[model samples]
Target: MPIIKSKIFTKSKKTSSFFITILFILSFLLVFINKADLYIGSKIKTVSADIASPIIYFLTFPFDKSISAIQNLNSLKNISIENNKLKEEIKILKQWQSLSLKLINENKAYKELLNVNDDTFETLETARVINKAPNIFANIIQLNIGLNKNIEINSGVLNERGLIGRIINIGNVTSRVLLITDINSSIPVKTLNQDINAIISGQSDSILLKLKFIKENKMPKIGEIIVTSGNADIFPPNIAVGKIYKIEDNIYYVKPFVNFKELEFVNVITKKL
Candidate 1:
């Protein structure tokens, strides 16, 4: 059995060797053919670049453009937001500027009121309005000045336009003014046109003092100016009170120069006649 197996192995080895030789020859021929036809370094590099460059460009072109567009859009949005913020800031500053101008004009008006000349009402003290009475029936105002500022009871209070009121009550640091429109208020007034003496009496809020004691035939006409007579030591002569607005048969009414609703400052004449 060993002899028979040895013979079979020898016959198979020849066939196997022939097949191996053919395979080696075929592999060598393929290698030589590939080397002769194509370059390994430069040619492979050129082909790879040609293929990859187009793919890279195709993938990155739109992405780069989109990135640039996004950056430009963000810049524009930032600029728009900043511009709006600046506009708002400018608007607020303009409001403040307008307020400052108004305050300056008001101060100038107050200074001019203080410089008013009157020898009879020599002693003068300035006071700022602080508050008003609660009801329409009580025409009283609270002032920042009081006895501490040399303001006394019965002190005449007047503004730039005309006579305002009298200081009826005085505290240490505050005083109460009784407006001329109060029912209890009474002052001697004279018409500038005819120089007719009359007693001015308060009626209501809108309607100020009515000129009394004038003869029915000698009533003042509408628009005639009324002024203090100086007969009473309480008020100075020639101080403008108001202008006549209406005359009904024998009675005449005058509208005050100063608007009590808009009163801000007043001068308290502390002089004793």
Candidate 2:
């Protein structure tokens, strides 16, 4: 029993010594880590900095690339949106420019009409065409002005180029114009070349006007200018009607300057009877 006790005590001492040696070794390692900068400061710092730099780069490289790609994508998207808006603006600007050009040309034509000085006809009031007859054969247009604006029945309607029609029906604020192309329309016109007076009758087409009541002794030649004669109380004299384009036997055909299909504005004469 005594020897067994002795062996047990010896093993305990050995174990205790082993634990003490382990604790000392751990203490020494902690001291070495804490004092490492002071002992080999410059060398250790340089080595650690170099190793840490690459490690940090490896850790952050993917995140940096992701952020850069996101920024680039956002910039591209903004540019695409802006470009689309600019294209729309450009399209609208082009439409406005075309409209402005059309207005300018119309204004010029109106100015030319104002400069005309035909003493036989009274002053004319410029009117805008508001509506057209559904059947072009009617050859009628509705004007903005009417009886309230001194427009009366038989008042002549003329455009910048030539005589267009006569006002047949007048309302309080609107008037209906009978185009020269109306089947019922007739104007006394004289040929510029031969001074032969003839009755120009309207057809369905404004481009074509028939010269009738032409004396057998006088035959009209092609390309002769035709003008309105003041003999008709409805229409003023010397108003440009058209030029003769075709002379088939005794009948003469004239092509008018005003295109009825594209009529926009007209002048209404308010003549005193």
Candidate 3:
């Protein structure tokens, strides 16, 4: 019994030492990894994402369908209320529509007289939002369409409400969208009534975006509609972005039309190159 116990103790000690040695080596390797700029973590993340993306898509498919169905039902429920509001709006819009048509015809006549010709075309592509970043600091979403669908970088993304954001990164079957609420985002905008031009810049944690490049004397009024001016042609002209939310101490802020958290689908406008 004593010899048996001695042999067992020897084996146990060797096993424990073996594990301890392994743990020490692993600790050193991890410390070295943390200190060195080997970029191994980046590579690992890329590989893991590539392997896990399809699995995630399949897992979330049913949930997405359910959400879409619920949205449709809610929309149906609100249709009557919206219809009543639209009826009143349409009555006012018809008068403007008639004037707009008359003005368009007059403008065409003037352009013809001046021998000026302008022709431009735009195409829109649809993409599904597959993933949304839960981090408040990073206001971004991932789309299911990418290079396969010819989705170009920096293409304007929007829903029915108005301009949302632009494409930032593209992968094989996915793309990342930097929302208008992201700190890195900026857009050229103009107020509808005053025609006061300014740049809209995003905030880190706030949904109300900042208005820049506006003169203090030309502050846009509250409730004024803001739209893309296409100053640099980054986005198409006259795309409704949002409304002026507040003006205080020579500062202007806008409330976005599209709720960033609730986005499911978007239209990517691909301009002709």
Candidate 4:
């Protein structure tokens, strides 16, 4: 029994010494880490991270989750605002596209339909337009081109969009134009089909014109473009007049290609080459 007790005492002392040695080594490591340079500090940090990764993750998991939710909410709000702005932009673009479509159609490939004599008419001079003061619908408007123009009467006047009128009366200083919408104004126009030759007459005080003398067999369909027929050498051929819109009682109504309300400048067709 005495020998057994002695062996147990020896084992306990050895175990205590082993634990003390381990504690001293840990203390020395802590001190060394506190005084370590960048390289040694980085290595220690890597080892420390491996040891504390799970605890660190446990403490910050809730905060990371909250931040992600906030980011998602902000993203949703931004997406909503952006979607509204895009919708408004698309609406505005659609409106512009309608107006642009008319202009584009006039500029399109009309060569396949008719031989547009583009080089025949020479633009004489550009003149500033003076739309009658409170009456934009007034049939007569004055040109700001001062005296000394021997331009003949019935010379075609054109705006940027298309032909608007013809010079009706040339005075000493200013020239007056008979607008296309004037009741006395009439243009010989034809469609892509050469057989569909007809006359477009103004509606007195309206924006639309009347298509006259269209035979039953040569009636122009809605949306078909009409241009100057150059009949009797009065005006240049292929000058886009308007498009047929409505037909009632065998009378077809045309919408003028030229926007007269915005008439700011005009070019006078002097002569056909």
Candidate 5:
């Protein structure tokens, strides 16, 4: 055992001594090179840079690429957040624009209603249309005002355009208005251009009104306006009703000035119950 230990120690000492001698020789050469030339120092620096450049690039290339990728991802995240905020702002602006349009239309309708200045009505009440649905009554509409507002039966109903319908049933808070388009509705009317009197009756399952009992001697022309004659004292005189658009087979179809689909507010102006 001791013999093997001594052999290992001798080999280690020889290896150490050889490295020390080589280092002493290199140190002496370094001093000689220092005195060699200023240009030699520059050449050594150039060679050292050539060798170290590739090693430095190899070490830093992956790190630089990783940093660039991370920066790009952060920029994309910021762009996404900004886009979401812009979308939300646009949505809110659109909602306000829609509401503004609705108000403008409603205001225009109200102005049209104000133009219906009737001087013959003893009682005038503004009513809101609550329901207009299809039923056994072909063209029936319900109003918000009824007996509570002293709304009378057989009273006249009109919109901004002209006379639309009449009141039939009166409740405490609501009333059933029989639209002029109903099959049973018949109004005594006279032509605007001529004094030809006739009964404007509603046709079954149709929106147009029919003129009946016109005197053979007085034939009215197309485009003549029709107004109430106040014969039965139900609808007042000179109240606008409809226009004669077409006349076929001795039957004249009158297109009412009131648009049933857009009838939102109305005026009930006549005698009360």
Candidate 6:
């Protein structure tokens, strides 16, 4: 009895598998028949597209979104990198703009200096300021041009703005300049409007020049333009010196046109006939 029951169970399992296979084959045949039938082919295809396409899309939706998200992340990172690079370039351009503006203003001043009236048999030699004493009281500077350039002792040194100093010591390839603001230095100056004569002298560490030799009864008015008087022959006559800044304690002071702290280049009078 037990053997018969086992055989029956095995037979039943095989029969069930055979029916499943047959059903699968029949389902495929039915689909192929519907596709081959001209009357039903279009209708069946339409139905499959409408129903199966949405089911397929739903199954793949998460994977497609993940790929799109990855692409978007890479694009954002690239944009950030490009933006930072642009910022650095803009900063450099701004610095260049500032430097260019300074040069432009300097050029305009040079044009005006060349237009000044002068009648002297002199040759101008341009030189760069190589060194300067920190103490304004010393008022000494060094130039790159020397005897080779025909630079002479007591020769007038000026720039586009006005007179800076005179060559006091000469060397083979360098020269020492004594600025007008030195204590031991003095230059004869005259007012442009009044023709009043005075001597402009420097005090230790002072930016203002002391006006001397004016009559006790005469006081120079404020804002009078002073020029070289050509008395000592150190500088040409009518060379710009400074303007009368103020008068106090029975002393008149003139402010020089050139700012000594920012001095860079100067023109040395190589010859004055």
Best of the candidates, lDDT: 5
Q: Please identify which of the two predictions, 2 or 3, would achieve the higher lDDT against the true structure.
A: 2
Ten consecutive residues with minimal summed lDDT in candidate 5? 114-123
Q: Tell how far residue 176 is off in model 6, in angstroms.
A: 1.5
Give me the displacement of residue 134 in model 1, in angstroms: 6.9
Per-residue lDDT of 30 in model 3: 89
Cα displacement (angstroms), candidate 1, residue 192, comes to: 1.3
**Candidate 1 lDDT over residue span 112-226, tens digit each:** 6778777767646777889976565458899998878988788888988988888899999999988888878899888987888988978755546788954555666789999
Put down candidate 4 lDDT per residue, 192-260, tens digits, no spaces.
555488888897778899988646575678889888888867788878888888888878999989877
Clashes (N, CA, C under 3 Å) per candidate:
0, 0, 0, 0, 0, 0
Report every candidate's CA lDDT.
0.83, 0.83, 0.80, 0.79, 0.85, 0.83
**What is residue 87's positional error in candidate 3, in angstroms?**
40
C-alpha root-mean-square deviation, each candidate: 8.6, 8.4, 37.4, 13.6, 10.3, 10.9
- lDDT by residue for model 5 (1-273), tens: 999999999999999999999999999998887788667888899999999999999999999999999999999999999999999999999999989987887777777676667566543678888997854335888999888898889989997788988999999999998889888898899998787899998875777899895587888888999998878889888889999989999888899888877778888877323
Candidate 3 lDDT tens digits, 1-273: 999999999999999999999999999998897867457778888999999999999999999999999999999979978998999899889989998987786555334324421132154566667897786455888989888988888888877677888899999889988888888899988888888888998997998888885555676678999988777767877778999898878688899998776666677774445
User: How many angstroms is residue 101 displaced in model 5 relative to the true structure, after the best TM-score fit?
Assistant: 3.9
Against the true structure, candidate 5 has what lDDT? 0.85
Write the residue-wise lDDT of candidate 2 on 114-158 in tens digits: 665566776557778899876546588999988678777898888
Per-residue error at 187 for model 4, in Å?
A: 1.2
TM-score of each: 0.64, 0.64, 0.53, 0.55, 0.65, 0.63
Ordering by TM-score: 5, 2, 1, 6, 4, 3
